[model samples]
Target: MERTLSSDLAFENNSAAQASMPLRALSTLMLWQRRLSSRRQLARLDSRLLADAGISESQRYEELGKPFWR
Candidate 1:
């Protein structure tokens, strides 16, 4: 004879939310790198391309002026 248990189902662990600090820091660093790369690309966009993306020159300037950490 065998018996089934339901108590274990109530103890699910949230592993993702408990990620290690190094992993978290790596993800944050990647985000900053992406921001820097994107800003560089935005800085190189021509006036026509900027207008097509619905971004004005002043708006591009503001975004490009921001620090990568931001």
Candidate 2:
């Protein structure tokens, strides 16, 4: 009976962990999507707009190609 109880507890913990994994994955995906969108939007801007942002045209191109620093 004690072994069964422990097994049930373990199962519950595992289930909760599994449920959280997908939420974490979804959040990560959303973050990446936002970053990519921002990068694309920045890339679409003309040189004048980039200059206004104080970002060099060449730098913008580099940043747009690789948005994530980490």
Candidate 3:
């Protein structure tokens, strides 16, 4: 009975660890998605709007290309 209890505890610990891996990966993906979307939105602005935002066209392109760098 003691051996069975130990095995059960080990199984539960492994299961919990496995479950957490996906959640961590998913949150990382979501963060990257948000960054990429923000970069795309900023890239969509016209040169005048970009100028108002103090971002040059070259800077906008650089930001768009590295959306996930942040």
Candidate 4:
């Protein structure tokens, strides 16, 4: 009986973890998309806008060069 209960608990935990994987992947994808979009917009900003945002060209370049995952 104990063994059966343990197996059932393990199964439930595994199922819950599996269900969460898709949510995690979706969140990661959305995060990457937002990062990429913002980087593109930043790249398009003029010097005045960048200065207003307190970001230098070199800083912008560094941020723009980073992969979305970073």
**Best prediction by TM-score:** 4
Best by lDDT: 4
The number of clashing residue pairs in each candidate reads 0, 0, 0, 0
By lDDT, rank the candidates, best first.
Answer: 4, 1, 3, 2
Per residue, candidate 2 scores C-alpha lDDT tens digits across 1-70 of 3534578898999999999999999988888888888888987898889889999987877787774633
Instruction: lDDT winner between 1 and 4, please give it.
Output: 4
Q: After superposition, how far is residue 68 of candidate 4 from its true place, in Å?
A: 1.2
Model 1 over residues 1-70: C-alpha lDDT tens digits? 8977656544433344455667889999999999999999999999999999999999999999899999
How do the residues 1-70 of candidate 3 rate in per-residue lDDT, one tens digit apiece?
3544578898999999999999999999999999988887997799889989999988888888774947
Q: Tell me which residue pairs clash in candidate 3.
A: none
Q: What is the lDDT of candidate 3?
A: 0.86
> Of the pair 1 and 3, which is ahead by lDDT?
1
lDDT of 1: 0.87
- Show model 2 residue runs off by greater than 4 Å: 1-8, 67-70
lDDT, each prediction = 0.87, 0.83, 0.86, 0.95
lDDT of 3 at 2: 50
lDDT per residue (tens digit) for residues 1-70 in model 4: 3534578898999999999999999999999999999999999999999999999999999999999999
